[model samples]
Target: MLLEALTHTWPWYIAGPLIGLFVPLLQLVGDKQLGISGNLRHLCSALLPRRIDFLRYDWRGAGAWNLIFALGTLLGGWIGVHLLGTGEIAISPDTQASLHALGVHDLSGLVPHEIISWEGLLTVRGFVSVVAGGFLVGFGTAYAGGCTSGHAISGLSNFQLRSLFAVLGFFAGGLLATHLLLPLLF
Candidate 1:
């Protein structure tokens, strides 16, 4: 019964409040910002033995907890999938049809193999979607100062005006990508 419950998706009401509570809990614990992009900077600072001013900070002191959090997230995902997952992606029929129209026939896994597989990586569409999209996301995260979880959850809960603007921009960009860019790419 516990495993059955773990395998199913939680309703937004239950999940949202839990996620919302995480911000205050995080603040109470460490007073650190919740974000994933900064981990890249921390990793670079720790690994790259360069005199570059940007990567010269004491990332160990600042981001050790964040690094641990990231590790836990990865571990949690692995456990959820390997131990608790039902091995079925429950995409709506309408969504499946829409994807099929876009030539994305294989919806067996979490992501479409048409765009994420090694064979797909060699295609122009895949190249643009994966490589270029990754570059744009990294650039956007740096420019915005945080990713969605950081800005929408933590920053907004803290009542930061910058995060409000960032969240709006993120939504607009997502809409544009979904409506305008995806059809053209596919």
Candidate 2:
């Protein structure tokens, strides 16, 4: 049933809030606060050669669930890509016109060129972009103490002011990086 929902009925509207509600409920029930960035600190503590910082909590306690979540995400993405079909990434007509105005004549070819290709994935530019983006996200997640979803959906629903600030900061930082800094640097 879950797989079917993933394949069929799970639109953004349903999936979005369901996730938001689930995270805090997990926190309420399990006594573990949810945040993606916290995992970075958690992970670093577990892997560091010298151990001095961690004196309170056990990293191993979080490991199993984290691994399971990681696996689920990987599996879901693969299924979404391959089995569920790469449905058109919807954008407003106005947004499409804006891309056209920006001299992007065709916005259709912008993603997943003929599905997941090893050649594409292994290409130096692609590999570097993925690695660099992943690294930055890791750093950001650590800095923010959560991913966008954790704050935007989970924390916001719980009426957390900190999460609101984090979400805003996330958007602001992303806009700065993508709009202002990325073209200059890349």
By TM-score, the best candidate is 1
lDDT of 1 by residue, 28-139 (tens): 9888777888787788789993998878998999889999999999998898778878467787899989988888888897777889878889998888888998888888
Model 1, global lDDT: 0.85
Model 1 spans > 4 angstroms off: 49-51
Could you list the CA RMSD of all candidates, in the order they appear? 1.8, 4.6
Q: How close is candidate 2 to the true structure, as a TM-score?
A: 0.68
Candidate lDDT scores, in order, read 0.85, 0.65
Model 2, total clashes: 1
Estimate the TM-score for candidate 1: 0.90
lDDT of 1 at 5: 77
**Model 1: lowest-lDDT 10 consecutive positions:** 2-11
